[model samples]
Target: MTPQDAQAFLDENFAPWVRALDLTFTDLGQGTATATMPITDQTTRMGDILSGQALAAMADTIMVFACFAHYGEVKPVATTNLDTVFLRPGVGTHIRCEAEVVRAGKALLFTKATMFAEPSGKAVATATATFYLA
Candidate 1:
């Protein structure tokens, strides 16, 4: 799917809480998708760092669109497993996530995402997810 289509899908399909992040889809390539989320009160923790939950949610959301980009269309896919590792505190005005489909099987798809703190451009978190194609 194009980035426009992916953005529309995000706007229409996500929950109100998820939409509150105000994620913007920047690019959509073969088997890959990239998005950015600004750090705000809704996404910051006590230390004023970007929350892990917010990063994980963005990773999960973008990975699903990466699956759609891989398949060339939107389809039913459920996250069977999502593993996120926090590398460092995200100390920036915004965070960017790049997700790619690692493998696509008939019944399952594997994807990975790397989230970086903008300006500093440091890796803050990484996530690998498995989705069940329905």
Candidate 2:
């Protein structure tokens, strides 16, 4: 799917809280998508650093969009499993999430995402996810 299409999908389908992150799709291809989520005070806890949970959520959300792009459009998909690791606190203007589909089968899909703080380009979090496609 095109980046425009992916943005439209995000606008239409994602929950309000997810949408509140103000994620913007910057690039999209057959099986990959790159998104940016700006860090705000409300999104942080106390240290002015981006929260790990927020980063994980953004990574998972980007992977779902990447899978949709791979499939040509939005199909019914559910997260079967998701694992995220927080490597460091994200302290930057924004975080970038690059998601790619590792494998796509008839009934399942495997994907991964890396979240990095821009400018510094430090890896803040990583996630692997399994989705059940319907």
Candidate 3:
């Protein structure tokens, strides 16, 4: 999808609260998606590092988008399980996340994501997620 279409999807489909993260879809394609989440003071923890919560949220959101790309449309999908590992403290103006689907089944979809602090290119977080696709 084009950037405008991706942005419009984010504007229309996501919850107002999820939209609060201000995620921007940078690249969208079948089985793969990339997004950037701007990091302001509100997104940081005590050390000014990106909050784990934000990273997880971004991972979850991007995986959904990855599914959209995979199927060429957004289906009614819900996150069933999500796990994230912190690799390092995030240090950057934004967090870039890339997600890809490992498997897509009749009732389930599996996706994994890697998050990095841009400009620094340091890996900060990784996530695996399961979604129930209706």
Candidate 4:
């Protein structure tokens, strides 16, 4: 999907809290989705490190679109499980996530996302998610 189309989808379908994340999709291709989130004070915790909650939410959000890319349409999907690994303290102006479908079947899909601190391109976190497609 084009960036505009991705943005429109995000605006229309996500819950208000998810929309509050302000994710901007830079690329949405078959089996993949990428987004960038600017690190604001609201998303940071003690020591000014970006909160893991925000990262997990973004990872889950991108997996929904990743399923769309895999299925060729937006299917009714729900996250059955999400696992995130905080590799390092996220310190940057922005963090970007790239998600891809690792495995896709008729009823279930597994996806993975890697988040990085921009400019320096240092790895921040990684996530894996499982979704049930109805």
Candidate 5:
């Protein structure tokens, strides 16, 4: 799917609070997806750093698109497991996550994502998720 398509999918399927994060799809390719989330009061926590919840949400959201791209269409999927590791403080104008589908099984999809603080491009967090194809 194209970036526009990804954005549309997000807007249409995600919850209102998640949509409020103001994420924008930057790129989409076969088995991959990229998105950016602006760091604002709504997305930040103590010390103005992006909250781990928001980062993890972005990782999960982008990985969903990765699965769609890998399958060449939007399919029903649910996150069965999600693990995120914060490597650095996310302090920047925004954060970007690049996600890829590592494997697509008959009933499960494995994905990984790396989040970087924009402008500096410093690694902030990484995530791995397992999605059950419904």
Candidate 6:
């Protein structure tokens, strides 16, 4: 999928909270998606560090979009399981998310994502998720 396609997918399919993150679609190709969430006070938990919840949600959303990219269309999918690990605090202008599909079967899709704090280029979080496709 092209970046424009990815942006349209996000605009059409994501939830309000996901939209509040103000994620910008950067790249979309080869069953993968890259997006950026600009850091703001609203996105931080405390002490000017990005919230883990936001990171997790962003990762999950990216995976959903990645599935759309691969399928060449939008589809209904529910998160069956989501596992996330917070590696470090993010303090930068923005957070970058890279999501890739590990596998996609008839009933389920598996994906993973890594979130990084730009400028510093530190990995802030990682996530793996299972989505039940309908």
In order, candidate lDDTs are 0.95, 0.91, 0.90, 0.90, 0.95, 0.89
Off by over 4 Å in 1: none
TM-scores of all candidate predictions against the true structure: 0.98, 0.96, 0.96, 0.96, 0.98, 0.94
Which runs in model 3 stand beyond 4 Å of their true positions?
none
Compute the lDDT of residue 13 as modeled in candidate 6: 73
Q: What is the Cα-based TM-score of model 4?
A: 0.96
For candidate 4, give the lDDT of residue 1: 63
Query: Candidate 6: global Cα-lDDT?
Result: 0.89
Q: Lowest summed-lDDT stretch of 10 residues in model 6?
A: 5-14
Q: What residue runs in model 2 are displaced by over 4 Å at the alpha carbon?
A: none
lDDT per residue, candidate 3, 1-134, as tens digits?
66567789899978887899999988988888999999888888998888889899999999988988888876788999999999999888899999999999999999999999988988899999999996
Q: Superposing every Cα of model 3 onto the true structure, what RMSD results?
A: 1.0
Candidate 1 Cα deviation (angstroms), residue 101: 0.4
Instruction: Give candidate 5's TM-score.
Output: 0.98
lDDT of 2 by residue, 17-101 (tens): 9999999999988889899999899788788989877888898899999899888888888999999999989988999999999
Residue runs of model 4 more than 4 Å from their true location after superposition = none
Error of 5 at 3 (Å): 0.5
Misplaced by over 4 Å in model 5 are: none
Put down candidate 5 lDDT per residue, 1-134, tens digits, no spaces. 89999899889989998899899999999999999999999889989999999999899999999999999899999999999999999998999999999999999999999999999999999999999999
Model 4, position 50: C-alpha lDDT score: 92
